[model samples]
Target: MDLHEYSRYDAVGLRALIVAGEVTAAEVESAARRALDRVNPEVNGLASPVFETALGHAGAGPFGGVPFLLKDSGPMAEGVEFFAGSRSLRGVRARHDHDLTRRFRAAGLAVLGLTTAPELGLSYATEPARTGPTRNPWDLARGVGGSSGGAAALVAAGAVPMAHANDSAGSVRIPASCCGLVGLKPSRGRTPTGPDSGDPAFGALAEFALTRTVRDAAHLLDAVQGPGVGDKYTAPPPPRPYADELGIGPGRLRVAVTVRAWSGVAVDPEVAEVTLKTAELLAELGHDVTEASPALDWEDVVHGTEAAEAAIAAPFLTAPGRPDPARLEAVSRALLAEAAELSALDLVAMLDAQNRVSRVVGAFFTGYDLLVTPTLGELPPPHGTLSSGEEGHTLRGWLEKLFAHGPFTVVFNLAGQPALSLPLGHSVGGVPIGVQFAAPYGREDVLIRVAAQLEEAVPWRDRIPPCFASKP
Candidate 1:
């Protein structure tokens, strides 16, 4: 297999070839290395290359021998350096495999390397002072939405069919929107974050990946959806394998669509137009699509999100070998200061706020089967627009900026709902515009079915990025 042939197949397709003996796993791995080498320089998506170690990976299962990349953050894999895009933790390595990483190995994904993220995964853009910017494959001048920006870029550039990603505040969906890939943030507790951590960010964070196709997303969820030992909670098991959901028709349903951001940010006109068109398309498909939004207290939402982000950054900043002040980015340093001042009562108040917001959003879902919105408030912005190193940003101001760029995604994190972003629209300039479909908690099956419908309705298989690995 060569880079061209290798780049043509998604993970499932590559697995099929491997299973049928059409191409050896070694050949596929070699081709993936070639793809990575060809594209990584242009996109700067890779944070650490463990090619030799990955070449020795051997396993058998559903995705046996398929090449994959881990995000620079967690679910950690033993011996793989995990900096979380931070200069302070530059040489840190995981002492043991995170439960999800073990599951990925059992599922037969060959771990290639770690991808870039913002410092401590703080920003909506992946321009880490530690690793520089992760350029969007669609347009080199634009940002790849963070913190899964690197994973999305590699998958978009055909360096790998899919790569590890996670979401607490739109990390997965934002990048998928920016890069024209399928990003699914599973219901809280649907996937593990265990052994080392339990329900990080108070169940706001969910682990998953970004993929080139919906079926790949479905298949992967099937392989890695269960809770790990000692998990705080678990999502209800699906009625059937998620892959089966792809073929099942999402029966006529009520969908609430909105272009307005809950935070009141002015959504880009192009993004709004695409979202309205997507709603029209849903109506044409026989569903009752209405322009409606859940009433949310933006203040509560902001406070809750800040608390969660602070919780995520706490241990890293408070560790005995704490990050040196100068080594940390401006925003990270600000977050450290904020984390130090955070009181237990403050955390409890924020958690209360999150619970209230979740209840309100949950009630809205009781009236609608799904909520459709633009995955982002705007198109992918130019690099440095959301830089972590830029000085003089309070945590509140920084989050406000992030919410402005990606106001549509983090609400679902607070609500703990299953949300998916599909590349169903594009800007006049050819940048991909993602439309998000969110379902009630533990209803990824519903999102998957509807996503499959849209994937077929607006096929993006031929929309290749300029920095693609297969390009001559």
Candidate 2:
């Protein structure tokens, strides 16, 4: 296979070619490197390039020689200087290989570099002072949402089929929506977050990646989903290999679709149109689709959800001995301040409230296999829309603003359920739009299966942005 062609292949295709010996992993790495050279300049998606190590590790797993990038926020790039899109740790380097990155390498992905992310994964837009703006491949001026913004940009630009991304909030889905890709944030504990901390508070959310192809996303989930040696929790065992289950038809799901969020913000007309269109498509596929919503107390969640999430996220704020106070964002600072004032009673109240929100959502699943909504209420934001360095709004206001802008995707993080963002719709301006589908807790197999089903319904693989197509 020509390197040019390999650059365009999705994970499955690249792996097949590598197995067939028609192409070598080295060649894929080379092609991906060339792609970075061609596209990174225009998009600023790649934070650092690493082809040499990738070449040495080609033909390693199911995705041998497949080009991929890490989002720079998670545990994967230990000893490799992960900036996490913040100025505070601009020169930080990974001291060890996170098990997740090891698993990714073992699965045969030749990771050639790191993708861009916003400061501390705090903002949805990916422009950081350390790295210039990571432009959306679809529209240069438009944002490639954070913190996986850079990965979205690169993959949308065809630099790679997929890249690693995680979402505590909508970090993964927001970018996937902006860049037109499939992003699955598996159930909490579906993927490892280990060694440093057992879980990031509330046990609500964890790590996963975004990809351009549903099949690729599903395949990686199979290769990587499991608790490492010392994880706090594990998603209940999947019914079957997710890749295998994709072949099984999703018999008429009692699909409940809601375009309006708990916040009372009307879903953007464009997002609503696509969400409804997707529901109709699901109905045509013989699934029962209904317009419905759960009793989501949006005002309550948005008013103080960050405080709850922050309380859960406290350990990660400081290391064992010397705390890295510099990396704390304004929102983080606000939460810490609140946490100090919180008593045992307040802690109980917070946990109880979080559970109640999840219960409200879970009850709806009793009547439906899944819930569908616009992944983000609005479209991709302009760069710097949610800056956190104490600008005008208070830290809580900034976070609340983000929740308002992206009201749809974070509840699952709170619900501890498996949710996925499927890239099946678009705005009239041609910006990519995403629809979120969530399954009950411990049923990632269902989430991935439905996502694959939708992938077949409305294919997005061919919508590669012009920036990527130009090189190939």
Candidate 3:
């Protein structure tokens, strides 16, 4: 295969090719560097290119020669500087390889670069004013869903088969949905988080990568998803080799479908159409899919789950002798100010509400193997809506817009279950739309099996974005 072909192969596919002696680690690394040199200028996805570092590290493992990129948020691969996409962390460097990075290397991935994220992984769209916009490979003028937007763009453009991304509030799934790829947020504690921290945010979530194929996600999970030494919450044991579950096929699932609550944001007709079809598709797959609204008060403002996330994120933000306090944007500053005023009772209320939401959501999942919803209620907003520092927009308004439109995602984050965002549909103007599929906590194996089956049913691998060069 040519270098271009090497660029397009997912990790698993690349492994097969290497075992067949069709490619070498050096060849794949060279291909990735060339592609990064070619495509990154327009997309602004690559934050820290590590071509030489990757070339030196290449060789051995299942993915020994396959190329990859990582989002800059969680931790850095050894030798590469990790910026976390902020002005404050501009020159900071990693002293050692985080566990996930070491596992990926052991499994044979050649890390070539780091990707862009919103400042401190705060924003939903990756249009940072400092490093400029991380443009969607599909539409350079549009915003790429962040904070994994950088990883998503490179993978979508066939620069690499897969790249690391972490999801807090839909970070992994959002960018994967935006870029028309497969993004899976494995259950909390499914993957090891060590060296810098263990289970970021007390087991509220976990991290992984977005990929072109379901098998690629599964293979990576097989390679890297393991219990660390001191996990706060432990997921159930995965079936032997997550890839084997892909072949087993999902049994008939009790699938539930829900629409976005009327948040006053106009639902894109294209998204609605695809969401309805996706439900039908699930039903056709011999599963029960019902168009039912979830029973709960989503709009209740009882100092709820959002506050819990804020509380979990505080020490990292407020820690002394770290990123300078003055360097934070006004939005972060304002949030810190609001957090300061939160009393003990306020925190108790937040934790209590989260418990309530979890109880309700958990019961709902008990009756179903999967719940399907639109990943986003609408298409990408016009650029500059977020991080523009625009006025008359309360933080509540901004957050409500994101949550209502992105209803299906954070529920799982709160419940700490596994969720998958599959880019299966397209808008009339050719923008991609994603559908969410979630299973019981630690049941990522189930979601991956069904998704691989669905992917075969409706092949999306051939769908290429307009902005990416089809032939390099």
Candidate 4:
């Protein structure tokens, strides 16, 4: 198939063509490679290529022969070098497939290569010191949100139909927002991270993908959800496949809408306008939408998140054969120093506060079926606007600055609830603006249905980026 034909189909559509004998997996792989060749140089999304490895996996599972990219930070496939956007661990390779990677292979996704990420997945931008920046497909100078920025850029540019991505504090959703895609962070424990790590970041992390269609996100979830062996936690099973919820009405429900940042960070006027417009659209669809924000102690949530991340960072700093200091960035070094200062008791106290905040946020959800907010507080900022290398800011000061730019999405990560970012509108400057819909834990089914409703109401699939592969 030609690149245009290949770029037009989502994974399911590509799979259907392969299954129907209308196209060969080899042909599709070639099309994807052509896409990579055509766009990767300009977009800077790919960190490394595993084209030969991908060729060997063609025809292996449900998506056998469909090209797929794995985010460099996590969701590792066995033997794939995992640099995590760090030069320090540049040659590190996973000894075994994390459960999710094994599932992706079994489901027939041909792993093409690794995508770029911010160093250690810590930054909201994908400008890794080691791999440089992964440019936004929408506008090259603007940042593609990280650490899943590479994955989102490739899919947005039509290098792949959908790619693996994970979210801890909006990595997946932020990029989806910036790149005009569908990004879903499944409920905590909904996707496994086992035999290597479990519940990383103290249950603040969840894994899923960035897709061009809501159905692709739903189908990919069907392929990857469920607990792995020796998992520390598991989400309650859905009554039916998540994909079945698509095109189905979500029923009349109460959805709380807020343009106010939980931390009181001032949102850009354009972003707030887009969010209110989305709320109006939801109301037009017969759902009750009201202006409301969750009640929580913002200080405790911020402190708790920092403590949890430090606790997670501590091991990496002290791990045997750790990266040399020269290879580490200032922000990473500062974070490591912060982690070194924390006592075990401090970590425990942070966990306790997080649990308390989770309960408070959970109770707020009791009054509404869903909460909606702008995925990011501002439009995608220009590259280098958030440089960790900037002098004079302490690590904590730098983090606060970062949060001010993206204060809306991280709270749900702390709460371990399912959240999705939908590309429902665009900024006056023409950049994409995604609206976030968060549901109570284990309620992705609700989020998906409502997203589909919004998808039908304000379609975004035809809004292709300038760097798109189907441009021919």
lDDT per model vs. reference: 0.91, 0.76, 0.74, 0.86
lDDT of 4 at 299: 77
How are the candidates ranked when ordered by lDDT, highest leading? Answer: 1, 4, 2, 3
Clashing pairs in 4: 61-108
Off by over 4 Å in 4: 55-60, 391-393
Error of 1 at 153 (Å): 0.6
Per-residue C-alpha lDDT of model 2 across residues 1-472, encoded as one tens digit per residue:
4445865678898888878888777676777777778888889987766546762343657777788788777655655766666555656666777778878878877777788887667677787766768899888888888778888888888778888888877788889888898888888888887776666655655677878787888899988889888888877877788888788877768889989888777678999899999999889988888889888887546533654456444644554332255655565455555655667776676677777787888887888888889998888877666666563445467667787788887788777778888888778888888998888878877777787777787777777776783454
| Winning model by TM-score | 1
Better-scoring candidate (TM-score), 1 or 4: 1
Query: Model 1: per-residue lDDT, tens digit, 45-146?
Result: 998765575823446789999999999888898877678888887667788899889889989999989899988889889999878899998899999999
Model 4: worst 10 consecutive residues (lDDT sum)? 49-58
Instruction: Indicate which candidate wins on lDDT.
Output: 1
Give every collision pair in model 2.
Answer: 61-108, 78-94, 79-94, 79-95, 80-94, 81-93, 81-94, 124-146, 201-312
- RMSD per prediction, one decimal? 1.1, 2.5, 2.4, 1.4
TM-score order, best first, reads 1, 4, 3, 2
Q: How close is candidate 2 to the true structure, as a TM-score?
A: 0.92
Name model 1 segments beyond 4 Å from true.
55-58
Local error of candidate 4 at residue 441 (angstroms): 0.9
